[model samples]
Target: MRSNHSCTVSSAPYANITCIIHDDCILPCSFRPTGTVVIHWYKQQIPVHSYYYNKDQFGLQNKHFSGRTCLFNSHIPHGNASLLLRRVKVQDRGRYKCYTSTRKGNQEIFINLEVKALIQSVNMEMTDETVTCSSHNIYPIPQVTWATDPPTAQGALENQTTIKTTDHKGLFTVESTLKILDNLSNHTYFCSFISADKTQVWTASWKNQEDITQEEGHALSISCIAPRGLQNFSLTWTFTSSSEPTVISRYDSRTRHTFNLWEGQAEPNQDLLLLGDGSLLLHKPDSEEHSGTYTCTFSGLQSRHIVQTKVNITVASISVDERSVQRSWWSTAASAAFVLLTVIVALPQCVRQRAVETSTASHRCNGAGQRWTDGLSAV
Candidate 1:
């Protein structure tokens, strides 16, 4: 039997470190001059574990890292010694160095592990009934989870999640859906994901709705925000009434866009009461006629925004006081005198006859009446 001489070689340096939730990450390392070698994994300049020759062992493994770290391949005959980290965490975000030892010499490679927390983007549908939150550009698939701040004793559910992996980019994305209740005005919810390394990444709380208020007899103006700078966009406004709600005015800038509503049709005079602003002005508002649901829609290359506002007509009432009563009485008396004068002027023949009768009666009763009586006796 030929005695086998075991030659030991050092492991290659590790590079391109990455971590994802629940998914396995490979820290790549390689060496030349293939031979029997031992590979060791170190975190932050401390020897935590070792593996080689098809045997699994720990050199100075940290209790917290036990059963969580492994080598891609322990057998070093072919000069391949890579570390596999499962379920990465924020604490695991640090420098990692791989060392290999062989009869030829000692070889080592340094790698930096960077862990990124999950990022969330929220959007709403045209109807504003459904809101979708999506997390993109995440590496190493992770276990995604969601919860509401206020725990539901009845287990009231408001969130759902889905995961998708792209073979081309070798990246994973998570999408979540939240159903808003009627009373959920500006209610906030959070989405979180945990990596296999027991690291937690959380996103900012998201609100599914916005609040808007407009005074009675005043036009309502609304605006939408777009990611990045404003480019080409489409806008539309819809009202609940039979009459089409005129788009009183609109403006688009490199940053944002706005739309306004006016009382009458969108004519020249009905344009923006102020230039370059999205505010609208109502001419004469009848709450019952103009108050209802109004929606502003904006669509761009990257995102879409829909804003809805309810117009409530605030009707003001005037009370009848002493001053008003006196004013009204004077107005009525003036109107009655004007009517009598008009009637007398319109009946010219009747007015003249009444005057003549009165004058003749007075003449007969006076001294001239005695002369007329004597003349009548003579006749």
Candidate 2:
């Protein structure tokens, strides 16, 4: 006789299961414990997985679920008949039926499965005053958005180019590029990739720090701080003064070495760059050649970019003494010009006043002389 013929079985009318692509998942089912157990999992009457005679039976299993479905054998006696699916695929999304039979009775449950291929990484890089954000192999077409830390005008986001392409596997690749105008350097920019269902979101950020001013023959250091706890990461620094960007150096933690691409562009200290914080140290930097924008990118596994930091370096060509001398010369010239203008304006008014005074004096002398002559005539 069975151990529990009167054991009760319970299950929900409907169950929902969500799984990520290239990952494992489980479809749940519940029943009463009994010595004799029989379970069969199906996708719309298509045989997925079956268990009977205290063992798994796959002779009639579907080809799509071959070697990918299994029931919890150890938990069978305890009334758990859940099916474990490995390396889920997009086609495995639909309603499934889990049928269980024990000595007590028989039970069945309906389950709905959803498969999603989430975005693995987002890459953001700046070239020629334009930043581009891109991602690949995403299912269910994602949405892209750009934002600034200080919240810039909407025109900044509107003036971008975004493209989405579908690969042969029906996966989407999205790329968006935004022009970094001079006015936007004060604000940090962020790009986000969001799934249509809003279940998965990946974002990356970039910021351009204030320009670093250095003398002509001074040693310059560009600091790039990445997030903590990165394994097998890569550090790439690029220099751009004009339209094109040149790769300065590249350091990979796995290789434990630095690869200098352009010699004269930037000479990164091998020891200091890959040491703790990954900051670039230039021994002696030239004023004209080294004055440009330096961008550092940190990439994790599979070359997926994590974050970016940009530094602007300005090499002052003029010395402090030269500036002071220029200021003094301008001051002296302005003072002399002011005095000349004052003399020119006052001399005209003085000449006009003198002429009026002379005319009045001559008229007074004539009147006095005429009055005396008239008195003599009267005498």
Candidate 3:
């Protein structure tokens, strides 16, 4: 009962469809609505899905596509034959053939599906002289690269170690670590995760701490400001004095709570305040305990930041000693000047008295000489 007239079957203008792995995707194909529709989907020559007799037919469907393929049945009457593919896999990337037949004629169209799982987040952390970069839940295994702000020599990165692993779903997890034998100050380290196809790349950077001076016994506010409008974020504040780094405080935006890990060294609830800018506030930091490196890491779903701040606590006793030394020097100089002024004033008065005495003695000697001369003349 079918006519020889060719049906108006049109292919998607965009033959390429990129879908995220583990997500649903649609392969588009349509034709003019004329008569009862019969559709069969194929990859190369392999049967993927079928529909006929006004219902879905799966007796001859491909094992790879079982329970994972469906057509827009409700919209089929409107000439929409788009196939919905569920839980896309990397192996599902290929040219798909959508063959449709009706009372008018039969036509087919080809659509290419590309599946990819992109790199989510690149996180970096530094502990002492070692820096680490990591990422997880990625498809098409990624490569890791390291660089420095000042452009370190190739030999400096010779000790870098990299590792890659796959999870149950065949997604990739990558990590790279490098020991910064070079000076850890004033240099910024960069890490990148690049997809195998080179289409997706995520980069994370960290700068070694420069000094932030805080005087002893002062209430200090170590800034670890998170990004604005960020949700489901976690903030961690850590301190490092010797070889080991210790967690001092933690805040999770999801829980809307802050945890102080410093125990006896740090005040509990009274020491922490969530500032408007998301900075951490600490009260009366102890010079001996808190005088070290403070690292604040803010991690969110889409972004990550690692900030290292060096807090050099100037000892209160040392400052007091310096002031005492300055005051002693000033007092000694003032007393010496007063004694010299007294000596100078007495010298002038003594000189005037001695001169008056010498003038009187000279007049008496002249009178005696005249009396002797008159006595000699009378004799």
- Residue-wise C-alpha lDDT for candidate 3, range 222-334, written one tens digit per residue: 66544445567677778889869988887776677777887544532323323324444556777787788878777766556677788888776656878899889889988
Would you list the clashing residue pairs of candidate 2?
Answer: none
Which candidate number maximizes lDDT?
2
Q: Which TM-score value belongs to model 3?
A: 0.63
* Cα RMSD of predicted structure 2: 17.4
lDDT, candidates in the order shown: 0.57, 0.79, 0.79
lDDT of 1 by residue, 1-379 (tens): 8535334544444465666544667777666544667678788767656876657687578876777887655345677777777766556767888777665667778888876544333343322554555656555555655545454433445345464655444445766665655555444444555544554454334333354444555544443323234356555555555575655445454334545454263212223312322233445556576666565544444444455556565664445786698889989999998998988787897788999999988877797878888999999
What TM-score against the true fold does each predicted structure earn? 0.37, 0.59, 0.63
Tell me how far the alpha carbon of residue 355 in candidate 2 is from the true structure, in angstroms, after superposition. Answer: 88
Worst ten-residue run, lDDT, model 1? 267-276
* Candidate 1 Cα errors over 4 Å, as ranges: 1-23, 74-76, 122-308, 313-379
As for lDDT, the candidate ahead, 1 or 3, is 3
Ranking of models by lDDT = 2, 3, 1
